[model samples]
Target: DNFLGTLGGPGITVPVVGAAFEVGIELAAGGVEVNLVVDASSEFRTTSNVIANSPAGRDDRVVVVGAHLDSVAEGPGIQDNGSGSAAILEIAIQMANQQISPRNQVRFAWWGAEEAGLLGAQHYVDQLSPRDIKDIALNLNFDMIGSPNFVRFVYDGDGSDTPLAGPNGSKNIESVFLDYFAAMSLPVEPTAFDGRSDYGPFIEVGIPAGGLFTGAEGIKTPDEAALYGGTAGDQYDPCYHLACDTFDNISLQALDEMSDAVAHSVMTFAMTTSAVNGTDKGKGLGKFKSDMEYRGSHLVK
Candidate 1:
């Protein structure tokens, strides 16, 4: 079955969690909370499931940090998503260890069926109400962040074309990344938002989105290689969608750097989101408070 109709579909990871909660409540009413239960009918019936962790903030606002868990049929997808997923897990664990309570709630989601086209992310977005969505400040999607041979690039979600505009005077999410890249002196190619990965859902609903991709599918031209440090004639990530995308295809140094960068960005945003371009002060709380003045006002005749 062509499950998702279009490119991306729901991996059903969270939905399965929701279902498990339903089943657990039903079963536990008899007074025994089973430690290990299996549900063959659940959408995420795979041996592997994305583990999610949430740090609730004081105001009930949320910021999402995401990576995909499942691999493609063609390859193990270690570099494609495994690296990103591991990074998210590490960041979550670090934050928890630090006991740093963020100003906004932070959610780490590991999506499934992304290669089948961004499914897990799509389903989660589809289930939210406008009010529910407004509580989301922005989504940081890490699809492919580690490749032994690749060029690092951040999403230019707001670049010309359709323009990555958002509701309620949302900030420009892309700038934060650009600034980070510039600070690091890394040669970055801004990948346009092409509805290619999980960031699709956030873009569709006017949520400011940004992410890092260590090149996949695209080739690195001589010019790009000269700017970055890869072979000019080779594909950006030669193993992309191929069976060679295993652990050996990744770089420990690259993974460590990217993971640290991701952690910095996540922590920075969680602590003081008021400075981020695409985030609105009220979006985190789902309401416009009387005291928070609107930066842009209309001309009332």
Candidate 2:
């Protein structure tokens, strides 16, 4: 859809590392720094992973938008994560296209072997020095976003009964969805982290993490169906983990709308990351403040 491309760019082919390197070069030239942090001992034994970064400010603090590039043995993983990986890629493209800069660095990660117990993410986080991990502001993960017969859910890492928190001390990093949903009057739902995806690694360390899911191996509840207009008692997303989970299984409407949410969240988080962390005053803040004041004065005038 044209809107999809505009809001989140068209889906690109996501091969392993060779393709990653080609794209990384463009990002480097665009004023965004790029890198690859590999875990040699990872179950996948592949290090073709790509980490693209754009600094909102000069602080080393980062806000991550991540999705796994590897697929499960089941099928091509189009909806499983093709949707997610593509959505994040579109977010990155749009960020570059709009020239929107935020207060903290925004890192886009394409993980590997997520289906094999979140190994790629765990490995990446494990490699982070204690200090590097501390510099992280939050992680926004996207997985399985293209299911047609699915309910939209956000990860509640702390389980606070609030869509914004999960059971542990971890905050509901997914609350950003509520903001965007409210703005667009879209109905939103909350789902617990339950150690289901890449966000698990982040939650393990108390770093807030959140992301969206259409649905997976679980069945849909009558209540969910009523709210979202799908058959209750059926698999939330029947095509999950099957070779049939092709691009056709996706709802273009869902993809178009959700991709917008992804882009907005990434951009919003990037810009407000410093404010949220009380570090907006770090180098980038002065320019941000000046921009805000200039805009504020224009409104007043």
Candidate 3:
């Protein structure tokens, strides 16, 4: 509240009302220090979602395993998505190699244009009929599974830890991952379904959804560092949305542990004989919290 400088200079301040309020505060004052840049360029484009299924026989309920395949232009997105993408694809391949037939139909999706606003996954859900939506037992989203300084995050599907929970059986889906991590003795925590990833579309239509995230732009607390072995006060992924988010940006330990959890949950639902639906099945529409908004650039909201 006590600084002003020339616009477009090395340190800009009080350039204008809107710019002043948005990015003029100093980092120490709990506001980000940033240089303002505006291209004002926009365009329309098309993209496709990539999907595949197991050759094995199908069951009545459908289990969707999804991860966004697109990345921001800054980096290759190896950890942000490559970890998740590779995790599911390997599971699909091994399912065929071992010829493991599940009790339900498993659909693997690598969604497109997620950075553009979760467009690909939303389109797929929007195209589904009522019956199609009902047939979907649940969804597993793995948006970012490997961060260099990471913490294992399972979606709080039942809202046990957050106000906005996922649809009906989301708790069951959450349980599957919890059990998997517990069995491995890995420290895990609940992450809210803030509608910032591909799962946003699935949960919006009453489809139970859950997944893992290794933290993005979220600072690691001292407690989390004590549990996960990382530098406290540092971001879980410091290179997020930047060119430095390359293969070296990933933690193989996080990838190994999280990927195992993903595989365990995916296979568990694939073969589960129990019904995941419940009374709340009819209440999923508009379940994503209305109070919070999705700010894609930071992804914390």
Candidate 4:
């Protein structure tokens, strides 16, 4: 008899559970080889949500800000994405409270099924018409911004340090955060545009996308600790994807700073996407890259 384990559906490559004892025995026998079998016979379903939002008059030019709202089965997911969801929700409320209007329409989205894959976002992008797609000025994504042992990580939109680069204007979007951090005298570092989050869908269709992440499963280094004031030789979020990712898993300081930055970017782009997409009615793209490259210099020794 074979023990069966449930998988999270398509795109789930990692094993949910495995027998270490069996593997150990196989490994002990030098010439032993192992054959693993997977039974992924299950039903798949697609679910939808009520995408709540407040629209602007300039519907032709839309600026989308999104965050995933779901958590892993194990925990509350407060830090993994609850931090991001809460931040955007508050920003939207404040925007409404202030009654501030913008040159471009700002649409805030709380995506579903982001943990399984970028399904919610991908479905949204697929449903838009070509004209509607063209109307989108840019996308801003926020994920895992309140990791306990955090670092200020901005997405590398210019592809200077990462293999993945967003469509034109992404570099400029990146510059927005970099400029904000520089102005605040906050130390910031570049995270790769690896499409590991909700932004992946928007960028796939050539939409300019950029966002912020504090940290995740990646370990913190001595250099990062020196720059960001956290313990070295520790995972950015020790409770990542685990049941321990409760309310206490968050860093209050990290959440506050990232929320402020989120508001700054939303307000800035709302007034003028000229710095992002371009001033020429979205015909031109900004090519400027921020001048902060400390790549390998910040890694653990």
Score every model by TM-score.
0.72, 0.73, 0.81, 0.82
- Among these predictions, the greatest TM-score belongs to 4
Off by over 4 Å in 4: 1-41, 273-275, 279-301
The sequence of per-residue lDDT tens digits that candidate 1 reaches over residues 151-232 is: 7777765454344433332224455455555666666666767788887887688666777888887777888778767687
Candidate 1, position 19, lDDT? 41
TM-score of 1: 0.72
- The candidate 4 region of ten consecutive residues with least summed lDDT is 292-301
Candidate 2: 10-residue stretch with minimal lDDT? 1-10
Q: Point out the worst 10-residue segment of candidate 3 by lDDT.
A: 290-299
Report clash pairs, candidate 1. Answer: 8-117, 9-119, 10-119, 11-119, 11-120, 171-277, 171-278, 172-277, 172-278
**Highest lDDT model number:** 4
Supply every candidate's count of residue pairs whose N, Cα or C atoms clash at under 3 angstroms: 9, 8, 0, 0
Residue range 158-209, candidate 2, lDDT tens digits: 4545433432213424445665677677787778767778988886775666
lDDT of 4 by residue, 181-245 (tens): 88678999989888789999888888899999998889999999999988899999999988899
Q: Residue 286 deviation, candidate 4, in Å?
A: 1.2
Q: CA lDDT, every prediction?
A: 0.66, 0.68, 0.79, 0.80
Task: Give the per-residue lDDT of model 3 (tens digit) for 182-279.
Answer: 75778799898899999998888878898999999999999999999999999999988878889999999998888777877777777766677644
Better-scoring candidate (lDDT), 2 or 4: 4
TM-score of 3: 0.81
